[model samples]
Target: MKKTYKIKVDCAACANKMEEACKKTEGVKDCNINFMMLKMKIEFEDGVDKDEVMKEVLKNCKKVENDCEIYI
Candidate 1:
């Protein structure tokens, strides 16, 4: 399944970095961060746990932008 999440990203670099962070997450299959919308679309691989994946998303996103929100 795919979900769109609201991300509090500052600029293009941060957005790109956030996308990379999400993609590197273990449970995630794909990720796209749109700077204009400040939203991140995530697709999970089959059998991946959504809650577990989101935890990874939140953790990695913090590395890109501290205190940023990622609404799933």
Candidate 2:
């Protein structure tokens, strides 16, 4: 499944980091962050609990960009 969420990121580079972090997270098939739109798009693996996956995505994003926010 796919979903889009609001996001807060300071810069395009940080948004890229967040996207990479989210893509590396378990249960996430892919991820993209639009810095100008302040949005994040995520594709989840089949049967994965999206809420749980998003929680991990947020955690991973924070590791690379501490001030970034993903409103799931």
Candidate 3:
């Protein structure tokens, strides 16, 4: 499945970091961070625990850019 969420990335560089971070995260098949739209698109892997996976993704995102918000 696919999901999109609001994000708070500071700039393009941070967006790139976020993309890398999301791709590294387990349970994510694909990801795209749209800085202009302040949104994130996540394509989930089958059998993935949605909430838990997102929580980890959120945690990973915060590591790169503290203010980026991923609306659950």
Candidate 4:
């Protein structure tokens, strides 16, 4: 399944970093971030718990961009 989420990121480059971090997270099939829109789109692998995955995504994003926020 795919979902869109509101996000807080300082810049386009930071958004890109968050996107890459999220994509590498387990249970995430893909990820995209729109810096202009302050949004993130994520595609999850089938049957995964989205909440759990999102928690991990947020943690991973934080690693690359300390101030980034993804409103799940």
Name the best candidate (by lDDT): 4
Q: Where does candidate 1 clash, by residue pair?
A: none
Query: For model 1, how does the per-residue alpha-carbon lDDT over 1-72 read when each residue is reduced to its tens digit?
Result: 998888787789988988999899998999998899888899999998898889988999898889778876
Q: CA shift at 6, candidate 3, in angstroms? A: 0.8
Deviation from native of the Cα of residue 47 in model 2, angstroms: 0.4
- Model 3, residue 19: distance off in Å is 1.0
Task: Give residue 2's lDDT in candidate 4 (0 to 100).
Answer: 98
Off by over 4 Å in 3: none
TM-score for candidate 2, please give it: 0.95
The candidates, ranked best first by lDDT, are: 4, 3, 2, 1
Give the per-residue lDDT of model 3 (tens digit) for 1-72.
Answer: 999998877899999999999999999999998889988999999999989999999999999989888887
Q: What are the models' TM-scores?
A: 0.91, 0.95, 0.94, 0.97
Question: Relative to the true structure, how large is the alpha-carbon lDDT of every model?
Answer: 0.88, 0.90, 0.91, 0.93
Superposed Cα deviation of residue 33, candidate 1 (Å):
0.5
Report the poorest 10 consecutive residues by lDDT, candidate 2.
Answer: 63-72
lDDT of 2 by residue, 1-72 (tens): 999999999999888888888999999999988899999999999999999998899888888888888876
